[model samples]
Target: MGNLYLARHCKTAWNLEHRIQGRTDIPLCEIGIEEAKMNVGFLEALKISKIYSSPLTRGRQTATIYATALEVPYETRDGLLEMDMGEWEGKTALELSALKPSLYLQWIEDPRNVPLVPGSKEDVFTAQRRILSTILAIYKENDEEKNVLVIIHKYICSLLRCALQGLELNHFKKEIIETTLPQNLSIVSSQVIEKCLSNC
Candidate 1:
């Protein structure tokens, strides 16, 4: 079993604009670069052994800073990819509400039960399954004492945290807001995740 430190990629230009960047390959803005650098201090004492990230540019960029600084092996994992928001990918909340108020409200109230788009849109449960499997597989590959760093997006991070805490996917909204707030980094032991999965 390994310990994992999960981080959401830092801010982007779209993030600054309050946009939904799901599955869009936007790079980190200048503020995002600085934000990731700031996290370096927080990670200085963690002694992370390996780094994994979403294949997206923002996640890759943020992970690169830490991987280079700590001299750890870094790789991109497809399972870490952000949710595919479909038609809503580049739209802001305000825009989405204006376009489809009822749908937007439904999403805000219960994202796990609502579909953002008609077809081919990624839902919370699907993404959670992918991310949970990825983390579990990674956990099985490492020793109990190893510390693994994984970076992805805010929504995925929230779902992963819910799983680690043995919470249902529906509880994701009740959990702390990881995207717009601090404490975007979460640490969970591999054993806890395994137990959570076994009980399920």
Candidate 2:
């Protein structure tokens, strides 16, 4: 198995506003730039075989910052794209919650049943699983990679948990995303493949 580093994008203006930025491309905030800079150690230590990232601005910015340390071209993978929230793109979670409380609740409690937003073409849950499958395929293909860094968004990050832990397919809380990261970008670190699934 290839080693994986599933990283959350650095914060953006929307992130600080507590607004939902599901799939709305936004640049990293200044603090996010600093945070991304601090991740240099993790990057240096990873000795990553290759760096992959979602195409969104936040993800791209984060990858570029990391690439400075890697001295390698960051590979953009659409497979790692963020979940498309459609009508809910720029609203805060609370704001959108008010607009679609029932849908919002279902999204959090169990995303599989969360209906597609009015104009979005894909279901959040389905998209997540598809992204995860793409990631797993990357993991499988990179048989010689010592470390594989996968830059993604919050929702897709939760999906990775399902892939690694066999969790029920659901939209799970932001904690799934937050906890995956350390307070300072330490979450979902570079772990040895053997150590990650020792029991297997």
Candidate 3:
């Protein structure tokens, strides 16, 4: 029964431009590095036993900062990777709306039902199952850890949050996406994981 500290990676240049960064290997911007440093104190107080991160540069960079500050070991996992956005990788929301209004509107109305992009390998439901399984595996493996930090991308974090709260995938855009901002942490308790699994 451990606490999972789920955090989104700090901002990248693409984040400022409001570009979709799904599966893109963008490094952290200067401000993103500083933001990670600033948030160290809060995370340090959690006494994190270990840190897990997405393999993406941004996620790894943020986890490295916290791991160094907290003096904890850290590792990366592929399951924590951002959803593959395919053709939408570098486009901004406005551009997507302009270029593919129907696709964009379909996503906005029902994210779970639509393909992330034309060539993407995983849908929202697939991503959700991957993240949840990864998290449950981590929890089971590190039973002794009082607090474990998991740094991942914004969309991945939102998906995990939505699942942990026992909400359906359709609730992701309306309930979780906007609120799951970068550098923000969401606490997931053992009981919450149990509840999530039971619901599944």
Candidate number with greatest lDDT: 3
lDDT of 3 by residue, 51-150 (tens): 8998999999998988898898999999999989888889898887786445865675557557465778888777877888888878877875467778
Q: Which is the leading candidate under TM-score?
A: 3
Per-residue lDDT, model 1, residue 49, is: 88
Please estimate how well model 1 matches the true structure, expressed as its whole-model Cα lDDT: 0.75
Tens digits of per-residue lDDT, candidate 2, 15-38, equal 888776777789999988888888
| Model 2 weakest lDDT span, ten residues long | 179-188
Pick the winner on TM-score between candidates 2 and 3: 3
Every candidate's lDDT: 0.75, 0.68, 0.77
- TM-score for each model: 0.86, 0.80, 0.87
- Model 1 Cα displacement at 73 (Å)? 1.2
Q: Which stretches of candidate 2 lie over 4 Å from their true place?
A: 99-101, 179-200
- Could you arrange the candidates by lDDT from highest to lowest? 3, 1, 2
Q: Model 1: how far is 176 from its true place, Å?
A: 5.3
Residues forming the 10-long window of minimal summed lDDT in candidate 3: 176-185
Q: What's model 3's lDDT at 28? A: 93
Pairs clashing in candidate 1?
A: 1-144
